[model samples]
Target: MAGGRIADQVGRVLGGRYRLVAPIGTGGSAHVYVADDTTLRRRVAVKVLQPALALDQAFLKRFRAESQAAAALNHPNIMRVFDWGEDAEGPFLVMEFLEGGSLRDMLDSGRRLTVSQAVLVGLEAARALDYAHRRGLVHRDIKPANICFDDEGRSAIADFGLARALAEAAWTEPDGVLLGTARYAAPEAAQGRNVDGKADVYALGWVLLEAVTGDAPPVADTTVATLMARANQPIVAPFGV
Candidate 1:
């Protein structure tokens, strides 16, 4: 769904600064818009939290704290978060605009990266994760959709602390709803154990494998089943990797 255009939000302005130009993407938690940062005189991507999440005071508080931490991260492979705040509409984050799309977008379009390309992307992502990990920040969510590319095809990790913030929230959901993507989840994450930087490494391995093979790690029908299927099992690489 290109842009997933929302007419009402298309012309709306947030925080009396960002003018929503067009919807760029929609995810399970929020809808992203390409907006004009009037103060900065530049384009930016604004991610507005879902209304249901906005209503949860606890979630909003955790989210605010996480966004603040993420905003302080500075690295070439990490997407830059400029500002975050709540307005009449809801909570929103201002981020650097990436024009090269995402790894998820490339895969969805039926394109598989060559081995060399996958390795390069993986290296950049690993560097970003390492930088964050050393500073006591673990990215609880690492998936194709969270890896965005810039105009020059440089990959950067996005949505740094969103999953952890969400997990801390008191928002209610259907029993089967999972906080992050099951297919890319690490074993410790799936088993409800404490996760460190290794979880991010595991997920990135899966992402790199998918990049070269054009397939997600095997998963079952249900969220529980999917997580259990890969929990303790080792991921087998295809021949010639």
Candidate 2:
């Protein structure tokens, strides 16, 4: 089989249980598949690490460690991790499958959400952040692509792939790669500084502003410069959609 075909097949019987149905999305570190858990007879979102990322020992270790920590946290607004382990192929994560598409996609449809709707989404995400912060976990990456909704329209934060557990006291700085979306990133993260839960709050505010205004806040060309700028400015009110 070709590489893609083999990946399709390996995805078929991940961990000798979950049967991959189709690829739902792909990120820098992993690919998410809609899968059926044969043993439990239920659906799940399966995240398989990219081969390139799997080859990086540091990334694999951080991936497993952060996922394990996230799995320990249970909340209504956070995507729940059901399992995390390495198969012969590579590392993978089994999580609750949320049916609704991402916030980025919704916004791209050109439908401006009402202020209440935006607040509801932001509030739910805020609660999730509060929960994670209490547990000393910082979701280093918070962007529209990482925020998802379910069938009933409840918001859940996704993509903990960049998550770091503060309790562990092991920090890995982001290198050349941008750790988060430029427009929504907190100034601290943009500046390559070590961040905590407040960074998430800043990012959430930016997301809420965009949700209501349909426009992203202006950002400086450089990440450090951007954080400095954000520190000085007051929150801008959302423009009428």
Span of 10 residues, lowest total lDDT, candidate 2: 165-174
TM-score of each: 0.92, 0.81
What is the lDDT for 224 in model 2?
56
Off by over 4 Å in 1: 1-5, 172-180, 232-235, 239-241
Compute the lDDT for candidate 2: 0.74
- Name the top lDDT candidate: 1
The positional error of residue 208 in candidate 1, measured at the CA in angstroms, is 0.6
lDDT of candidates 1 onward, in order: 0.85, 0.74
- Candidate 2 lDDT tens digits, 1-241: 1347544653468888899888787654557788999999999998776444545667667777888788888899999999876765557889999999788878889876798898889889999999989888888778888899899999999866444422132333332223335567665665668889998898888787777777876766665555566666654666543
lDDT, candidate 1, 99-144, per-residue tens: 9999989999999899999989999999999999999999988989
